[model samples]
Target: MKVQKFIASNMIEAMKKIRQELGENAVILNSKQISTARMFGLLKKKQIEVIAAVEPQPKMKDVRVKEKRKPLSRTEKKPNVRNQSLTSSVYPADEKELNNQIEELKDMVQKLSEHSSPDEYKYYPIPVQTFLDHLRKQGINGMIMGEINAKLLNDWRSENREKTEQEVYQSGFQHLKELLAGVEYGGSQFQKKFINLVGPTGVGKTTTLAKMAAQAVLEKRKKIAFITTDTYRIAAIEQLKTYSSILNVPVEVVYKREDFQKAIKKFTDYDLVFIDTAGRNYRELQYIEELKKVIDFSQDIETFLTLSLTMKEGDLADIIQSFDDIKVDQFIFTKLDETATYGSMINLIFRNRIGVAYVTDGQDVPDDIQKASAETIVKRLLKGLGV
Candidate 1:
């Protein structure tokens, strides 16, 4: 057997080196991540070490012919069917070992393909790689992941030694905080009299509006009323009415611009007026036009684009783009507890240059909602990542 060891900056390079030196038939005996001392031992650079071996070819001179023997009878070959069945039911130990090795190699290749730029992440420490994997599983986009990789690599190179999982998480948190620095967060400041909630169908806009209104009435001790333009759904109107009844706040249902104007006039004496727009297919431009006609956007109003975290990233992006004509002040991410992945929220915020006002976890009136902030968002995103 020909045995050789190969070392490279990543698994791909290591596999290439092994194949080139030991041929395709070579078997991987062992592989592991290793750190090499660098910069006069002040820092360490990560590398992959792989050991492989290939069976040696037999020499022609060593070949010898065997004497011919009589063939076995048919009866002899047909015997022991029970033994054959028993053997077929159980895999041989050697074959099982080979299958395990193949699976391991498959997993390595899968990990390589997961990265958008594998070369860029080649030298990342184990903890950093694990952190990046966690981010990927959380549905973070490739562009954001690439940016994060660069930041992590820069930090890893500057440090004298390897970073622990917790240290990597802290670094990620700090970088995310920096990314979200300029965007506005937190619940309404009450600076605007009319707080309008708008989004596509089934995003829970009416419920979210009720939550925000509940907070204002119960916590802030502010007078608020509901002006719902979601007249398309009788249930939505009733749902708002139910919430309004509980809060002892009045609700005005509007079907047209004149009715909306009258509702605005009626709520003029109130501290805040929550406008719940009809949730329709945002892909249709007419819904937005209808919304414009109903709601006085020119008034002292803050428009919030409510979204469900359970939706796909592509769908969320499309919904955000569909509202390009309207002036969206911030976002309200709903159903936070419905999905384990939260990266879509970060992706949208980073791409659209918008911030979150609130995140709703459940159906509870106000308890499920929380005011969004950079710290709170980053912590939620990095949850269960060894933090």
Candidate 2:
């Protein structure tokens, strides 16, 4: 038997090399992953190694005799004792093991061919791998990563274009921008009279609301007022009051639906009325129901769900789902500086089909808060990656 070893970036390619060099009948003896060229133990590259062997052709007479063998009847005795010794010699224990290994390798090849054919990402270029690692660090969802890899590879191959590393990076950035298209990002126009901020506790909902109010009053020169349904939290109410005092905007503390209506009437002449709701443990259904009792969602209002970028993606997804019945129109991500990964925001935006209105990196009132946009978000996601 002739034995040879093959290596490639992935299993599919390794098999291809094996078949090309050793002929179609080559048997894969073993396969494993390996890493090579370690640079200061940081930049090792991954590779796949496959061990293959091609057996020598047996005599035609022996092949024909083996093919002609038939099953013995119950009345027939076992093979002749003399033939048994010859048979044992012809098929030794080691040969039997090798044949079993060959059968297993054949199965592996079959399965790989069925699943990995037409897979372009099996040979991802260095640039693509670098970007992929950066995204993985940003906590981007695995499914999204897979999707980007597949689409990027397909496009790269179909275009038949020789793109430089910079070009590849730009293409990835552009693809992200396309995914975030049709999303409304920025300060609320307040086309509707009421703009409501809602979310769980400590997500900086009150602070974000304050930032929005500041933008509307100082930059847009619009008459604005505050109506908060967060009477449950004295600190929240007090916080809004402080912002209200600073902006010289009138704020009404509402406890019930009637109180909310009265507050709206009181701020009827204002250009914008920002409503803040009490943060609750949204995992409980009663809190959402209590929200319906205290806030009037029936009014012409745009509700922005405030979320923290530091929150885990699973928890963030659960929080958004908890408000599914509440008609959340958009999102406002806060605490951007607390976490390096901004992938949670992107995941929320795409999965919820909602756009981001604002993002706050710190507690510097309006200065920390900026109008969210695709360009800004993608930059945050790829910030330190040098992509």
Each prediction's RMSD over C-alphas, in Å, is 8.3, 11.7
Model 2 per-residue lDDT tens digits across residues 63-178: 54675455999998776666566545466567668777777777875664442322233235566666766777677776677667655655555555657767777777888888
Best by lDDT: 1
lDDT agreement of model 2 with the native: 0.79
Top candidate, metric TM-score: 1
| Per-model lDDT | 0.82, 0.79
lDDT of 1 by residue, 232-289 (tens): 8999999999999999999999989999889988888899999989999887788788
Each model's TM-score, in the order given?
0.72, 0.70
Pairs in steric clash, model 1:
none
> Candidate 1: where is the Cα deviation over 4 Å?
1-123
Q: After superposition, how far is residue 354 of candidate 2 from its true place, in Å?
A: 0.9
Candidate 2, residue 164: lDDT: 75
